[model samples]
Target chain A: MASPAYIAVDWGTSSFRLWLIGEDDSILGERRSGEGMTSAAQTGFAQVLQSHLDALAAPENLPVIVCGMAGARQGWVEAGYIDTPTSLSAILTGAVSVPGQSRDVRILPGLAQRDRQAPDVMRGEETQLLGAIAADAKGEQVVCMPGTHSKWVRVVNGQVTGFSTFMTGELFDVITKHSILSHAVAGAADVPADSTAFESAIKAAFNKPALATNLLFTARAGQLLHGLTAAGARALISGTLIGAEIAGALSSAGQGAAITLVASGRLQTLYEDAFRTLGLTYTTVDADAAVRRGLSAAAKAIWPNNERKS
Target chain B: MASPAYIAVDWGTSSFRLWLIGEDDSILGERRSGEGMTSAAQTGFAQVLQSHLDALAAPENLPVIVCGMAGARQGWVEAGYIDTPTSLSAILTGAVSVPGQSRDVRILPGLAQRDRQAPDVMRGEETQLLGAIAADAKGEQVVCMPGTHSKWVRVVNGQVTGFSTFMTGELFDVITKHSILSHAVAGAADVPADSTAFESAIKAAFNKPALATNLLFTARAGQLLHGLTAAGARALISGTLIGAEIAGALSSAGQGAAITLVASGRLQTLYEDAFRTLGLTYTTVDADAAVRRGLSAAAKAIWPNNERKS
Candidate 1:
């Protein structure tokens, strides 16, 4: 492969992050902006990029690559989603070409499932997993990435085999704030990572499993009848949903696969603790690392000959 | 009392429907408008009243009584909520005067509950319950008002005694559209509501009770293991939650209470079926009818001198 410089970008629902690198994969100046997919609609694509590019003092003509919601139908360019059991190269092949004045902008395609009888799709996370896989260089490594819509992806030979989405973040918010579960929640305050209360909640929910619903009722009934505080009850409900999410993800990936957990914020801590409770093994990787790698994967794809070698 | 006609407006979150109610408890004229609470911040308070008043051909200076979200903290007048066991008259007596309005517009306060450790407040549902209580004229009755945020209220001696709010509609929408529950739901264009299926879901959820979460998992597992349709599974989840809501309301109200059921749209049908499932002895009333009675109750309070014989 001919040596060439690469650029990477991780664009999401509410935030945008970009990076510049060389043929050897050494990092250059990196930039971030609040111009996520939502605000990008108003801020304009060119402006969000310019603001960050200007700050980085990087050449605009570089073959810029993008991953995440930026490729969504509402985003800058609809790169589309690569179907399941497809390789990262398939996404590169499907990239939506965005004409950049000073540079070549290519939006990485996301992954999708249309034949499952239910058409579901994803874009950004696959790029992250590809980066993780490329970095790991290990065989049969699975990546569990947590977010508003958490994903459990399987990979083999630097190609994403398959993945499933879970609306864990949204569910947690809803159950704790809007549902009967809110009555038992202690307060609006965040439950500390690996806290006994949260850990206990995880254990109870996964253990009894059937009691999840009845446990929800306890949020209200506990406060009124059993004198459980709203905050505590909320935590209990959160623990249950999250624990269920972990179980759901594991079941989707199928057991016996090696695990690599890519996470951040409180969820990672809780998930780690849950892993111990369930007697599972995992390697926790920082979320940003995978995202950066995701950006690199896209960069290496369009300008294949320019891809950096380790 | 001073020859001034008192108007009671049940200005909801989405619509502004007012009663140009007379002190003698007679409707002079009624007005409707698309302008609601959300648009109030832009339309201006004076304009909101003028637009509605113009439709009814009523004078702006009339002693206007307002309930519902229109009297929320950010409403035309921030009339606070009264505690439980509150009388319609007591709330009217504690009305907060709106600023800059030439007319004497008394925005009747809603209800507040600090009886629990944390304070919980409610506004619009209070007036609807007042209307239901007034219309029934029964000593003790429970009003099962269904909506996005459904409220189960207890009225005793024509007063709102206590109540609880359920995020039923919101939860149903979230689950069917956004969660694993969505996997089970048939597209609206595809499967129509089947009561038998609904009944079966309720029985499965309530029978063993603890099976609610397991039942939810079945939405995913049934699709994988048993080949259950996502649409059908969604229906089951819908049936279960609604069934749980009905069970929750009935249990909260306890026995030996006269009950009135209030709802509209598909929710009305679902709730009706749910009430039927529980064999509840309830008096069914149209949503609009209760709102008018609620307005009439508020009007009767401040304009007692012009009271009409029922």
Candidate 2:
């Protein structure tokens, strides 16, 4: 059995994931919980990390590397941000140390684009970019990371040129849960059972991205006038938001740029279908694997001497 | 004072307004409440209307004219709809009468555009349109009525051609209150105090409606990176939604089509500012007066002899 060398934690706003990495650079154990930055802030970050490590029976001296919102101003420690255009490797150098811990603890910094007109910032995803794209990759790449706030990042020859964050997922949640469309989608399946409505909405929004909000209204109007099903209405809302996001993302990208989608589970299937429906060229990367790989890269870079102990 | 001749009411989803008209076409009494369809539906629409009428001491035989959601399927009675491509005066003939009432009580029908691609409907706005545009008006007219669900109707030579509904005001409300942008604009003035942010956001969204969701994120990013004020964030959100709405509304409008803006109060000021910032030519009309005028037109058409009863 390979001995555990270090712990990798992705502490987001509402979720926490920890991986126990062996000396051989393999995952020995993992723990996931709702003890993210928000929860950890109240429960004590040190205590939360200790509880997770204790659950896994990790070694007391196991060095920990953390990413995501744990490094935010309101989180455990302010790791700050590396402003663009920056090399993916620059993130490694910006890690801030949490002093007075029993073991070495470092948190990765976020990335900020200071453009006055299109100001943007991203946390955690920058690490995923490090793992998803090879350090020496050639040409321009458009990377999409879909979640609560879907991010479309542009990379030119391994350096992140810029990126934009679309409030697609969050808007979909609010519109379906709080807006008038809520009634239109009441009792609907979360994933939308109506694929046809989803695809058509994708096309409609992609072609006329300007009519996004109007298209959203059609969910209710369609239900009232055309007797559209609840599932169909939900699908229409999701597809419209996703389609508009893609359109807006690509609008600023160089024509024919290779697309790299970083997502897993339902988001992966949805985006793949959207790209196919829009007739766009793209490839996919497993999000979980990418983030894990990203954490591994950071672990190795920060602790070069922690080689495999057979 | 002239004796009360009839009662005019604009009963909407969340609002109720009533005015007792005199024989001289003046307001004899006025009442306003929050007992719109949603509330009145539970408490009995007839009961709600009676309470207000009783307070005004309206004559037992005084007839009533109603518009807006009161005519909706779920309101007092199912008033149905008048299909589009019809004349504005056609709305007057489609009034549905409430049965078992001592006095004549007629609820005007709404307008419905059954276009499969863009199915749309409007209840109260049609009445506003009836009063906003003259029956014998000529040429193409683009009417912009801003509110919770802002309506943009396209009329050709006094005939209702088609219209679009943008969820601008509602989206702004949800995004600012329910979404992550809520934090960026926490404690900000309800109406944005940052005119610069508002105007800039308006131009940005109007010019690039596709990037709306992305632009929305800037409210947060701007705060984090550029130290944007809470008011600025609020203004940006409002401007983005309104800008996208205006762009979508004008996309189908004929070139140089005259714009008739029917709005009052804060909405009137906001939309007026938007039109001016965009350098678009338009004429403003009071929304309250327009709805009242529409109800008056319906009353005269339904009971010609009621005019100047004194």
Candidate 3:
């Protein structure tokens, strides 16, 4: 068997995961680093790369492919984002060369939407979505990846058509931490996340005779008017935001399209139920698994014509 | 004139300002501390207070009157909040007492709105609003204080009848700093604030379709459709958010009221003009001067028997 000869790195704001791939497109070993591009910006990323590789037998003559925030302008090197209706097939055929990397370490450009009413952009996540779509037969599907910045993507014919990110989690954190909503809800961090509160808030956010900003006041107001506790109020705020995102995405991208929630953990269950309650069809995929598969697929694309002989 | 005996403090989230208020209600000496309640959460505010006092000669046996974040939950001491439609009358008539070094000190409570559609709260700044209104006898005015958290307050019959806090500035900071909007504009830390750009954005924000959040995307979208520059696009976002805030506040509390903007600085000036354009009667006040007036009123409230003697 031909030994592993290349690496793929998924570097984001808070963490980094490295995959060592064999010539057969199988993972030989994987490593995780707490030092992501965002935090290790001043410490120099290439230094951390050497250490991460050293921990994994210090393999020689191996090229590295990178994705995510590592390509942000503030990253180790910028992997410029390509506009949407973007595809790996198209990117693979029309790739831009990033200069000055150790042993052919190339950064994958993100996907963006310029023509849309809102100019939406994505980085490493899109490449993974591309890898996911490439693994499937040509069909149109909506992939919802929920995170600090939740994105709803439209993939058609093995190509990423477009996507939009909702500042759901950040806004949640802001409103809860900074707004009076924090006083109403209790134990939000540790709450088992009762859907009753989330469901009701969703209904309020969409049906209210209100402004978007005023919705927040209702969070603080709910405590007084309805005796909503701090945690409950916060849960309502979360529900309202996520619910709004779902409603917005439905109206924008997945109005008639099939949907799959590419998320895991409790949040995955939440998304699944959210979609179900909305009468929207969705299937769940393991997040870590999807990322692994994506990194491997990207590795395969970076090196063509070389097959692993076992 | 009675000798200066007391100190009045209005310490808040980002900056601390104090007035050595003499018995005649004249400012004896003034000082400011970069150390505010927000940053000192983990570092012990008592230490900060001591250090600041150390700089100024520790005064004799006299009381200190303070009104602001020095009394929040995460403040030096949680002086608690007074529910809204709350006026200086209630605060002065029902003031809370506190212990101090060799003398007594009082921390005035911030105003909170529980009966309003949503529960909203404000501290420190309300005192300034009270002071501003106290200086001006113009009855029944809507006061706008714009900053990281902007407040549109209604003062009727010398009492703060109702008010709401808008997270306008913070939202702008977040959207510009962390969201996709960041990419549409330069991420330079010292980027100059373009008033023209800001004004245009405020106009766009108030423009029709009545409202749409994806509406803000026009900033980035215009860049694509018409090749808008980053500066102009950024201005649109700034204007849209502030405009939306004005719209939100207008619909929320500032509606159907005589409006006056009790704030200064280029940013506040921009908002004052926006409010005027929106057909709201708006006025601007110098923040520092108003803050001074607020402390004086608070001092007088605390020591009514010790009235300013000619």
Highest TM-score scorer: 2
Q: What is the DockQ score of candidate 2, to 2 decimals?
A: 0.88
lDDT of 3 by residue, A1-310 (tens): 5587687788887788888777766778889978887777979888877788888874666877777888877888776767777665554433344566556677777776876445666667776675556455477788888877777888777777777666676666655654545566656564426577777666554443124555655665566446666666666677667666676666656477878777778678767766755667777777767766766666667676434422
**lDDT score, candidate 2:** 0.93
* DockQ list for all candidates: 0.06, 0.88, 0.15
Better of 1 and 3 by lDDT: 3
Top lDDT model:
2
Provide TM-scores for the models.
0.56, 0.98, 0.70
After TM-score superposition, what is the CA distance of residue A218 in candidate 1 from its true location, in Å?
Answer: 3.0
For candidate 2, what is the total of clashing residue pairs? 0
TM-score of chain A of each: 0.85, 0.98, 0.86
Compute the interface RMSD for each candidate structure.
Answer: 8.4, 0.6, 4.8
RMSD to the true structure for each prediction, in A, is 9.6, 1.2, 6.3
Regions of model 2 farther than 4 Å from truth = B308-310
Who is ahead in TM-score, 1 or 3?
3
